[model samples]
Target: MTSDTREPAAPTLQPRNTPARVSFWSAASGIGLIVAVVVTPMFWLPYGSHYTFALLMLGAVAVPAGHLGRRRGKRPDARDRGLALFGIVTGWLLILVSLLVFVVFTGTLAALGLLFGTLD
Candidate 1:
């Protein structure tokens, strides 16, 4: 039997998987770290602006991560979800705690100055 008109089978391409994990969550962590580092230096500006910028960057990372995390071949485990939640919560907590510490330190310094006659 001679097959002269049959088309060749196309090669199947495997989809990438690791990027789904690294791009979103990893990038988010980086952005969160940057925000934490920059907050103190730029604290004089409005807090809302800083928070909004951070949140926007987080959402940008999340969009790709969300899609990558839900692939047909692999399902996200409880541990992954837990880790993500923990990271987010920890970031906010760090910010809150740092702000509190700054407030307390400044307040104490101001009070001490007043008491000692430095700011009379």
Candidate 2:
């Protein structure tokens, strides 16, 4: 066969309107973090409990997502990478925000308690 000189085919671009699919569990876990951020302060959960919850959510959801992405993409696509990163950051930021909220809420409560001459 005569040698064929071809530069090889370039990858085709996806349509601009094609939306990237999000992994269901990955998103659910992220939402779980958001909930923890809100609920911890509202319910007056101890910081340790909030931290524990965040850890469980990460282990149960985010780690599995990374594994699934690795299986699906071999080298994960931007969408997969973004989902994985968001999952991680969601858990971390939730913990951080929860701690901040907890401190502020407790401080305010303490100050108010002192003002009333009784600790609640």
Candidate 3:
């Protein structure tokens, strides 16, 4: 009679040159996203509403920022990960709400219906 249980294999870490390591490109992307979201609307061309700029820019920012958040540092700490992710996600949520408000104010949703459909 023999025991069937086996020990789990330990996770092997890769060498320093691992391709997945944090990179300048990823960090630059993260910084760009955050900066554009926070800064661009102020300098944006005159528009009908703040929501227009927010709608256009914030969602664009959140996706890649959140992606790069994980690999922001070669050895990112919990705070780095948390701040990056929270900033991205929160910014996105705000943008979505702002877009809804924009659709209501600008009648954009109604306009789309008329583009290819006959309006009585």
* lDDT tens digits by residue: candidate 2, 19-73: 1123345446556666665676655354655554554555455545544553554
Candidates ranked, most accurate by lDDT first: 2, 1, 3
Better of 2 and 3 by lDDT: 2
Question: 1-120, model 3: which lDDT tens digit per residue?
Answer: 898998999986533421212222333444564466467765433543653554546555654665565454346232245545555565565567567757776686577787757755
Cα error of candidate 3 at position 12, Å: 25
Lowest lDDT 10-mer window, candidate 2? 14-23
- The per-residue C-alpha lDDT of model 3 at residue 83 equals 47
lDDT of 1 by residue, 73-103 (tens): 2543322443344344444544454466467
- Give the TM-scores of the predictions, in the order they appear: 0.37, 0.40, 0.40
Worst lDDT run of 10 residues, candidate 1, spans 72-81
- Candidate 3, 106: how far from true, in Å? 3.0
lDDT of each: 0.52, 0.52, 0.52
In model 1, the runs with Cα more than 4 Å from the true position are 1-79, 118-120
**Cα distance off (Å), candidate 2, residue 100:** 1.5
